[model samples]
Target: MAIFTMMNSLAALLLFLISSSSLIAASDSPFILAHKKATLNRLKSGAEKLSVSIDIYNQGSATAYDVSLNDDGWSSDIFSIISGNTSTSWERLDAGALLSHSFELESNVKTVFYSSPAVITFRVPTKAALQEAYSTPLLPLEILSDKPRESTLDLAKRALAKYGSLISVISIVVLFVYLVATPSKSGAAKGSKKKR
Candidate 1:
């Protein structure tokens, strides 16, 4: 009878724990996360450009409404828009949903660029207040100076690709010249025997 009572107490404790955990999970609201990245490209006309990509993700259990992304972080005079707008808005972002935005920018002047974090704002269904989040900050980018230096391995690979046929032709020519300039010992021996 004592063992039966202990089993009942253990089952009650387990039920209580499970119920309380569910209550805790039900109170959670929507969580918004944002990420931003910029990449540099050199144009055929010797112009430098930047491509910016932004991603917004809803990671919480609830949906986010009136989701907006703003990226007016750079000076307009310095960086002109080549394509696409810097900001966008959406009606709703459901839980575990992701949205992406991209834009191209070009700068003619030679100067270093310092970018600011993008702003993301959304309204949660459960709350009256608006929630805001900032994207991760990026490092400074050099416009005139090459933003990133190439590795020696990458440089060698590019050089070989561009000058591969030239190198091959030079190697073949050198081999032919060596064979024509140097006489064979067998030819000399045969000539000496014929003369004798």
Candidate 2:
């Protein structure tokens, strides 16, 4: 009978420990979600300016502490942070909370495509762990020129400049046709004199 009692107590302790560990694991994990949007403006001098906005969200049940952002692979020469910071700190972010930041960058227009790396760091007290999360692959920015196209009149002027002799000959032929089609006073006077 004592042996049976001891076995039951041991089983109960094991079950309690398992349940507590599971609860701690569930409450200690933090999930971070991030997204980015970018716009590119191409300049006439073959340079481009990019504007980017990043949004971060805490989706886990625990609060995140000492939250900060970092750039992973972006180069300083190729990108300049004109408007906002590449790294920022937040005291704490509760679950379901959101943070947003914007950055403006300039680079040569020759770079057709680009992706900037973003990393987020936070601390979870329940697990006593410092964790890092990366943003999903940023959508690439494509530079496009909005230069005005040449008009039909402009094209004709250019063609005339290149083929001046041919156009002049055509103009003379058209003038001769006009004169031959219209009866002139001199021709009529000569014809009357001949008839007289």
What would the TM-scores of all predictions be?
0.62, 0.55
Error of 2 at 18 (Å): 24
Question: For residue 166, what is the lDDT in candidate 1?
Answer: 100
TM-score of 1: 0.62
Predicted candidate 2 versus true structure: per-residue lDDT over 1-196, tens digit per residue: 9999999999999999899757755875667888877778776667788877778888777788998887545567677666777778788888879988777887764544667668999988875668888876766555554548999999999998999989899999999999999999999999999998
Whole-model Cα lDDT per candidate? Answer: 0.87, 0.78
- lDDT tens per residue, model 1, 1-196: 9999999999999999889657744767767778899998777666679999999888777788999899999798788899999999999999889999999999776788899999999988778998899998878877757557889999999999999999999999999999999999999999999998
Task: Tell me, by lDDT, which candidate is best.
Answer: 1
lDDT, candidate 1, residue 114?
92
lDDT value for model 2: 0.78
In model 2, what are the clashing residue pairs, if there are any? none
Lowest summed-lDDT stretch of 10 residues in model 1? 20-29
The number of the candidate with the highest TM-score is 1
